[model samples]
Target: MNRSADIMILDLSESSAYKTNLKHIDFCGSPVINKDHWLYWGSRVLSTSEASTSNVLMRVAEQTEFLDDETFETIAGCSKSENYSQRCSRTSLQSRDKLMYIQKEQLGLESEFPQHLLPDGKFNVDGFILACDVSKETVLHSNHVINIAKSIAKTKKPIVIAFTKCDEMSEECKRHYMTLFLATKELKHVLCNLPPVETSAVKNVNVEYLFGSLAMLCLRSQKLVKKPPLAYHEASLFVEQRNLHVKCCFSTLLSQAVPLCVYPKKFLSWKQVLADIDRHPDLMNFVEVFGSRVAFEMYERYVSEAKELWAMNRLRSHVPRLFEVFQVFLGVVDLADMEWNMARDYMRCHPLFSVLFENNDYDLGMWSPSTFNVDEKSRLPAEILLLPEAGNVFEQFRVGRSDGVVAIVNGK
Candidate 1:
């Protein structure tokens, strides 16, 4: 089965018109699965005593012994116009609030088996269509809505909130719903990311756009894996010898070529790099000039070379678990420090070059403003390094600052 074609509609609103809405929201002849656990009042319930106190909830509470068993089933029963209207009278604001509370309280009590019941083994759910009637009073604030949303939070699937019965709403009511929908982002965590779309199966209002949007979302959701980083050993290296034209950021106060003069000599590995970056008065500033990726590559090369040196000295066992520790740091480190953490993530993208060090891959030439005949005291070139390759238009460039910059130049 085409997993991409599979779309699941979660009737968490427990709308009696669920079947009608599902039938109306066409998936371009693709199979649509209906889950009845929410609609039918069965045996696997929250609390019969609490449910018994409210006649409305009690009827909903008595759905079926097994949630999979559909005594008041929608798929087979919702066949006619009258069937669409034959629903519980709990669509009011107060009733919805109570229902939400019950749903939230009974979260783990019932079986989640219905959720896994896909159309077939070959297919996976592409998106969740949350069907809620706009004619109803309550909306995103209701507990059931939050509960259903939270249930699928871990799935990382895109949620499309379809406001049904739009034809029955006035322009003012539609605006109100839209207002509420947009306001949901402020509800925190759950609905912040979901987009609410107005749809009406009866009038065919946004039915086409509804499914079309889903297809588009499904398409966009399939992210391509990023291409691996260029390996230092594999990359073309240009050592400064003859006069070379290059663009760089320069500060005259330092009176030195930024990349060559600035060095975190005391730090040797990822651990020392991260630990001392914030405190080292000159390291971060130097990193800022050469660009983060180049700095990261530099440190990465340092750690790799250090490891090789240790192994050569017959101290392989003494090498700290930098790779493993760096991986952990990559996953947890804040984005604020992400520029400096590139080495930690290199293993995933460039596994082969993730180890060892090579001297020929880089130029060890010292650059000074005096070479350019600049009389400015402590002048530092912002574009500290440039590696130009033969034939290939793309050349790697680095610029350093707290906010780092790296670029591939396609031409001169």
Candidate 2:
């Protein structure tokens, strides 16, 4: 599959979409995404590539076991005129963290599957769908969501706004919310002439236009990178670099265990301090999941020289699992399947990786202003002594706080 052709539907659960992703996916050619479990009450689904969608979601809505027959009649009547079910049939969907990916070019890409964050800390997809619950308050709250969309657009990625649950709205309510949402600062600037597609997974309202427009937008976005394929060695490196990045967060209280040696250990050496850090209760948690070797790579290493082995490396920032993940993602002449997914699945399955695709930038107390400034009184004090002494007034004066003498990091 052309992984790059996958489009992300950012699952901003906190953005007031009010848990509409599953329903939307159910409506968008993915009712049977996971054969193990049905998302809701969909009996059969209309494939995105199909020509007619009249009875597609209408059938699902009609089969909604919880609904009254009269209600089903009310909903089925609204599905007659989306004018284009083929657009939606041309796509597929999956949700991971704050991201839900849809396949455009890879139209048959698995509807529901796990996704990994490429070692460069980027999702291996193109385009985006920013979904919002169709409510007045959610419409207003979506302004923040649009700012995120703006950033995605600035990166030259295609993005679209999906006002989900319009089936629950009145015509006037839809218009009011659209007017309010479209007038948002970032919305006007980023979307420009593009209008949002109001969708109703229940009624199958405009479902085709939403994803169809996105597929075309994503296709158009790829025109800029339509150059010839990379050379053999370059392709090898691209596959090697597609490894997923892992970050382990800590949530336990280490209030009793000290984290800062800013006061200096009488016997502290640079490597010794790092070794102590490697054994830190919070950090050692990573050793449990990723092992001691991973712990060494995360805490004991200086800079990685291998990072530049591939051209245009995507990971712009460092994460705890960089070295191990480097075993991947080089582009190739032929898109043969690699064993990358096995490793990726293992990495993502870790309990500490709950926020794997969350957009939050975590601080494990690894950075301080001291690294940037030479002066002692900066935000983070430089460790002037190779081994700190408790009696050293200089070290005491330069003390800077970190996670806590005992603290949890990332979500471990």
For each candidate, how many residue pairs have backbone atoms clashing (under 3 Å)?
25, 23
Count backbone overlaps in model 1: 25
Which residue ranges in model 2 land beyond 4 Å of their true spot? 1-4, 11-123, 135-139, 170-177, 189-193, 221-412
lDDT of each: 0.35, 0.36
Span of 10 residues, lowest total lDDT, candidate 1: 57-66
Tens-digit lDDT track of model 2 for 204-323: 455555655555455553232223233323433443343122233421212112233222122233466455455566655545445556645643232222122111121222221222
Q: Candidate 1, residues 177-291: lDDT per residue as tens digits?
A: 4564455543343244334566655534554445544444444531221122222112212211110111121122121322222232232345544564444435444454345
Using lDDT as the measure, the top candidate is 2
Tell me how far the alpha carbon of residue 165 in candidate 1 is from the true structure, in angstroms, after superposition: 1.6
TM-score of each: 0.28, 0.28
Q: Relative to the unseen true structure, what is the C-alpha lDDT of residue 124 in candidate 2, on a scale of 0 to 100?
A: 39
